[model samples]
Target: MNTLQKWLGPVLFCTCLGGGLTLGWSATTDLNKKRSSEVAVLQNALYDQECGSCHFAYQPGWLPARSWDKIMTGLKDHFGENATLAAEPQRQLTDWLRVHAADHAQGGKIQKMVRSIPAQATPIRITEIPYFQKEHRKLPLRTWKENPQVRSLSHCATCHPQAKEGSFDEHAVRIPNFGPWKD
Candidate 1:
């Protein structure tokens, strides 16, 4: 074969491979950006009223189904408080939470949270998750205890102003007394 004929095949192959790689990389980058932005917002009125009344109505994507199941069943002693609900509403909320728990949730943030948990662990408190601990590890214990506005780490919305909307982006965080977090 002539030099041009022999070179043509390799040139076309390289061009196709480069183009395919670029497209794949672009799609992956977009997906990751979307996933890192936020989680699904809380939509159920019952969940908001019942859970939000006491504490932040955490988005179901924060925990796994097994964790939700355990929490829902033990409402009488929910974090040292009696949050027992009626049978019908309890069942409904349990089902809803199970369907949207981190294990079954969409987005990379939710998946990342799930991955941080051990396989045998069923964490009832979102604060108990390894991902949650790691994220807040930099904060001093005094931040949670001394800050009256943020009495506990469980109070996510206290610092995360957009937490109710399911956005936990660090840039948007505004600690009660500490101001915006840099890390």
Candidate 2:
């Protein structure tokens, strides 16, 4: 090949490669920034009054939108309780949950939670998550059965006092009768 043709091909290839690298890096940086945002709190008063009345109004960022949709539609059989809501309130809660669901939420915790589950899995409870299970698996059975304060892992606030505020920092964990969580 002629010198001009050979040099031109290499130049074009390098330019395209550099451009691709720059775009990829920019996208990764943006995602990292979103994932590193300060802890987000569930601020919806209506959600607090409606869902929180029965149980901890779980942070929407813990599960995917599909899971929320399934739970919202199946409230009549919600963990064996009649949690049926009026159409209007149901719509509002569903909307709120969908907007803040794990797949859409920003933060490393949310991203990791989302990644831990299969794309098709529709987990109604955070405790059903593999990541959550693995994290809590170290705890003995007594913590769930014998411990009066912690009857179930579903009771997030039992150990994580800041759960209502949407914070689950390991450093903040305090188990009843067991003292602070180590590791």
Candidate 3:
């Protein structure tokens, strides 16, 4: 009985270790493939001129076309700020956002965000996406509300210096008042 117990323990440990290694390798491969490419930054002169002037110019791929439409229609009360653009610029920006929306594009976190959302949901804010929320679940509430540099989750660039380039790789994250993120 003693001999059997000793053998069984090592055998079970070996099996579990092998299984964990296989799963970890496969997960890394899948994640690497999905995030290999970065979404193109917002390059439209009008988009940058109007939106970038106020805050970081979020890439259109962050949300779906319906969300963009909702945002454009509500420009008069845009997050409590009146961001009403002229008729022509509004139309152009709306068209640009739609064409590059998450559902219309491929690659990276944007694709994951699109898949995480339900068909009925039309989230105007990137922070409202399930994937974004899941990624931030480890963060303390004070990190978003009390941290002056990271006053809100909408301040993407506060923690993500490469946010402007549409690169949100976890390896690039640097939380303010804290150190590098560990996942």
Model 3 scores a C-alpha lDDT of: 0.85
TM-score of each: 0.78, 0.77, 0.77
Write one digit per residue (lDDT tens) for candidate 3, span 5-100.
979999999999999999999998866664446666657888889999999898887889999999999999999999999999998999999998
Could you give candidate 1's per-residue lDDT for residues 1-183 as a string of tens digits? 699999999999999999999999999997657656568775799998988887888888888999999999999998899999999999999999999888865556787789899999998888888988898999886677678888889888888888887878889888887898887
Tell me the lDDT of candidate 1. Answer: 0.86
Task: List candidate 1 segments past 4 Å from native.
Answer: 1-36
Q: Rank the candidates by TM-score, best first.
A: 1, 3, 2
- lDDT at residue 138 of model 3 (Cα atoms): 85
Model 2 per-residue lDDT tens digits across residues 24-70: 99999875664454235658989989989889888888889999999
Error of 2 at 118 (Å): 0.8
